[model samples]
Target: MKKVVAISIFLIVGLASVQAQKTAKMEFKSETIDYGDIKKGSDGLRVFEVKNVGDAPLIIEDVKSSCGCTVPTKPEEPILPGETGKIEVKYDTNRVGPIRKTVTVYSNSSEPVKALKIKGTVIDRESGS
Candidate 1:
């Protein structure tokens, strides 16, 4: 009975460790962005901060936007452990009304793909009275 109990506890701890290892070590400050409100025909900028919290280095391969109206920029080099990086997002408000965009990031860490989202409402300019 004692041996069985010890074996069970070992298995449980091992499983927990494995599960934690499978989880992505990379993290982001804010996964989503809310522009809140803006005027039409305007442009906006946002920066997403990322940090490496795992033992391995964090390498961002690329960043892609959902549409041409949105642009994304990121660091060119790899971020060492406990280092920081940035993802710059630009939105062009040509069309009016609410807007939701996504920026996909590819990396060389445990979680190779990371997604960042942005949402906001655009108010059209009032016409001359």
Candidate 2:
């Protein structure tokens, strides 16, 4: 009888934990952003949409890129549940050639660690004939 009671309690706690996770979740519209083809020294800004699809507020602790060439800015305020937010990424288009970078996102959500990607090519300006 004691073993049965203990097992029942464990099951209840496990179920509660699962439900708690769903209460603080982050859902991003797209994890990867493609810049396509761009010219060197051209605009290098993009936005990634994210939503807090949970019951708790989403707090973004930090945002970082793979290298200095790529910079990502996180939202300054917490995002309430059912609300959307943006993460801005800027790539140094001056560096010509293929562009492949990753952005790391840290937030107080069920999925605390997230990775975003930026990819494309930066074509060099034509030289004077």
Candidate 3:
């Protein structure tokens, strides 16, 4: 009886592992977005394109920015396998200076969590400083 129980448990565990192998995969068109040099108060919105490369639906759980100056938005709906989605990020262009930020993404993709980056400078053309 003990031998049968152990075998049953082993089979169940193996089946669970097999099921776990099928999951969503997130593939980004580019890991970084460059805002380049822009004038103050210019449009700060940018998008990061992503694709679901795995067999399952890609569900983005959360999107966060490293600093309050930057805001990141994730897709509200699931991205089906082979479909594409967009993650929008907006940086406060009012702050005049070099811009460097990180956006973290949490999702059901196989990778679970991913970090994206943005870089560039915000220039105040009117104020020489």
The better candidate by TM-score, 1 or 3, is 3
lDDT of 2 by residue, 31-110 (tens): 99999888889999999999999898999999999999998999999999999999999999999889899999999888
Off by over 4 Å in 3: 1-18, 127-129
TM-score per candidate, chains pooled: 0.75, 0.81, 0.85
Instruction: Compose the digit string of candidate 1's lDDT tens values, residues 26-99.
Output: 78999998988888876688899999887767878899999997899988987888888899999987767787
Better of 2 and 3 by lDDT: 3
lDDT of each: 0.84, 0.91, 0.95
Q: What is the lDDT of residue 40 in candidate 1?
A: 81
lDDT-better candidate, 1 vs 2? 2
Candidate 3 accuracy as lDDT:
0.95
* lDDT tens per residue, model 3, 1-129: 999999999999999999889899999999999998988999999999999999999999999999999999899999999999999999999999999899999999889999999999999979743
lDDT of residue 75 for candidate 3: 95
Please report the candidate that would top TM-score against the real structure: 3
